[model samples]
Target chain A: AQSVTQLDSHVSVSEGTPVLLRCNYSSSYSPSLFWYVQHPNKGLQLLLKYTSAATLVKGINGFEAEFKKSETSFHLTKPSAHMSDAAEYFCVVSDDRAAGNKLTFGGGTRVLVKP
Target chain B: SQTIHQWPATLVQPVGSPLSLECTVEGTSNPNLYWYRQAAGRGLQLLFYSVGIGQISSEVPQNLSASRPQDRQFILSSKKLLLSDSGFYLCAWVPTYQETQYFGPGTRLLVL
Candidate 1:
């Protein structure tokens, strides 16, 4: 069984400041982790993914995440937050061994970037 | 360069009405398709998945069903709409050999 937990329900960051969204996962097998961003009324967009090749993965729009095995975490980060970065972010996990390669998503963290 | 498409960007239906939302993928063959629903302030819920034509697997038990009539086409349908079904619906496709799933612009459904 595999699952993900996004520690924060909401995060507020000022424009030009750093941003961090925490996520933790539990899986019996090697897990594939991903971060997705969703703007209002828009579909979820893949930001980055960790497939056991790299611990630090960079994504579009200056977003990146680090996979910490000992911590069992894949937390998203950005050096500087922009007003346009305000959106809902989800942490997802998938076990390749699972049927259909089903993905399990976290509750999501709503980011509010203020200028 | 595969792309996914979903029709009826927004819809408003009366309770008990029928529903049909279509999704298609281009530039790829034998892709795995999926349907997901996101309620307000909630994460995505996987509803159905199809590995090939005429093959579908449903994840949740609800008033919804999915079908794949073509190799690149997947459809979500319901005989009757429920108030609880109002949410953002997303369609996604993943390559047979890859784990990353690409999503299409979602359909926003509102059942009155």
Candidate 2:
């Protein structure tokens, strides 16, 4: 079984400051992880994915995440936060062994950016 | 490039009414389709998935059902709408051999 846990339900950061959203996962097989962002009334957009290629992955909108195997974590980080960054983020895990490419989603972390 | 489309961007229906939301994919064939619902302030819940025409797998037991009539067409339907069924519904598709799923704009349903 594969599952993901987003440690923070909410994260508040000031514009121009760094932002971090934490996520942890458990999977029996080699897992694929993804980070998606959803703006209000908008569909979820893929930010980045880790498929055992590299530990550090960079994505759109200046977002990046590091996959730490020892910690079982894939935390999203940004050097600077923008007002447009206010949205809900989800961490998802998928086990290739699972049928239908089913994904296990985290509870999600709502980000609030204050200028 | 593949694109997923979900119709009726927003809908308001009375309780006990029938519901039908359509999803279609472009630029892909025999891809896997999925339906997901997101309740307010919550994460997404996988409802149904289709690997091919006439083949569907349901993840959760609810007042909802899904069907795939065509290679690119997937539909979410209900015999009767319930208050609990109201939420944002998302349609997604992935390549047959790929793990990444792309999402549609989504439909907002409100059961009154």
Give one digit per residue, the lDDT tens place, for model 1 in B1-112: 7889999999999999999999999999999999999998788999999888999999989999999999999999999999999999999999988888889999999999
- For A1-115, candidate 1 gives per-residue lDDT tens digits of 7889999999999999999999999999889999999999998899999999989999999999999999999999999999999999999998988877789999999999999
Off by over 4 Å in 2: none
Error of 1 at A46 (Å): 1.0
For residue B76, what is the lDDT in candidate 2? 99
In model 1, what lDDT does residue B105 have?
98
TM-score of chain B of 2: 0.98
Candidate 1 lDDT at A42 equals 93
Sorted into a CAPRI-style docking class, model 2 comes out as: high
Model 2 residue A19 distance off true place after TM-score fit, in angstroms: 0.4
Query: What DockQ, between 0 and 1, does each candidate earn?
Result: 0.86, 0.90
Query: Model 2: number of clashes?
Result: 0
Every model's TM-score: 0.98, 0.99
Give model 1's TM-score versus the native structure: 0.98
For candidate 2, give the lDDT.
0.95
Where does the lowest 10-residue lDDT sum fall in candidate 2 chain B?
Answer: B1-10
